[model samples]
Target: MIRTGILNPAVLSLLARVRHTNTVVVADRGFPLWPQIETVDLSLVDDVPTVRQVLDAILPQYVIGRIFAEEEFRQVNSPSVVEALRDHTGAIPLVFEPHVEFKRRVPHAIGLIRTGDSTPYANLILESA
Candidate 1:
């Protein structure tokens, strides 16, 4: 039995298979479910386990090379949510693209983690290092 690090079996299994340069998305509640991509739905309730909460849990287990977000994230999401993401990311560079373009890239990610955050455009794409 696993004693520590991402307790969710599905999440752990997905992360275990992630390779360098692979993409994983940690997205908000409203993010579309792509039929072609594997999705790990973690949303229990509105804002129950937020994007930041999941990111904090996953950050230690993965070596992330870069992060991608919707260009409107700053203007649409709460300041606290944005700040929390920035704090967790630290030195990792954040690359922003239009929401349409961001969604276009989701199908290519190895996995998409759906969080309970209600904030608008609170999605993030992490590239494994």
Candidate 2:
């Protein structure tokens, strides 16, 4: 049996299909998942598995081109979460897009990892590198 790397079957499936410059959305629990897009739901309970946590595990395995998150999340009064993201992704810059725009963009994502994070609009669309 497989005993190394990603143990999550869904995550492993998405990771296998991800390629350079491909788009993947690591979104909040409430983020809408389009029928046409592939979704990897890792959420078990509220804040059980954070969006950043998921990225940390997946990003190292996959080469990501860039990341897109809501502009509003940057101005968050609680800087801890954003700071965690900054620390997690490092130099990979985050592009700010409106909420509607974020939703519109997810449908085109090659894969979407839905997290249980309750943070406001804690959604990130990443471009495979």
Best by TM-score: 1
Q: Give each model a TM-score.
A: 0.93, 0.90
Candidate 1 residue lDDT tens string, 34-114? 888889999999997888899899989899999999989988767886787788889988888998998887888999999
lDDT (C-alpha, whole model) for all candidates: 0.89, 0.82
Worst 10 residues of 2 by lDDT: 74-83
- Give the per-residue lDDT of model 2 (tens digit) for 7-80: 89888888788776778889888877578988878899998798878887777688877888897787763788
Provide the lDDT at 98 for model 1.
Answer: 96
Residue 90 of model 1 has an lDDT of 93
Q: RMSD for each model, in Å, please? A: 1.2, 1.5
**Model 1 segments more than 4 A misplaced:** 78-80
Lowest lDDT 10-residue stretch of candidate 1: 76-85
- Model 2's C-alpha root-mean-square deviation from the true structure amounts to 1.5
Q: lDDT for model 1, on a 0 to 1 scale? A: 0.89
After TM-score superposition, the amount by which residue 88's alpha carbon in candidate 1 deviates from its true location, in angstroms, is 1.6
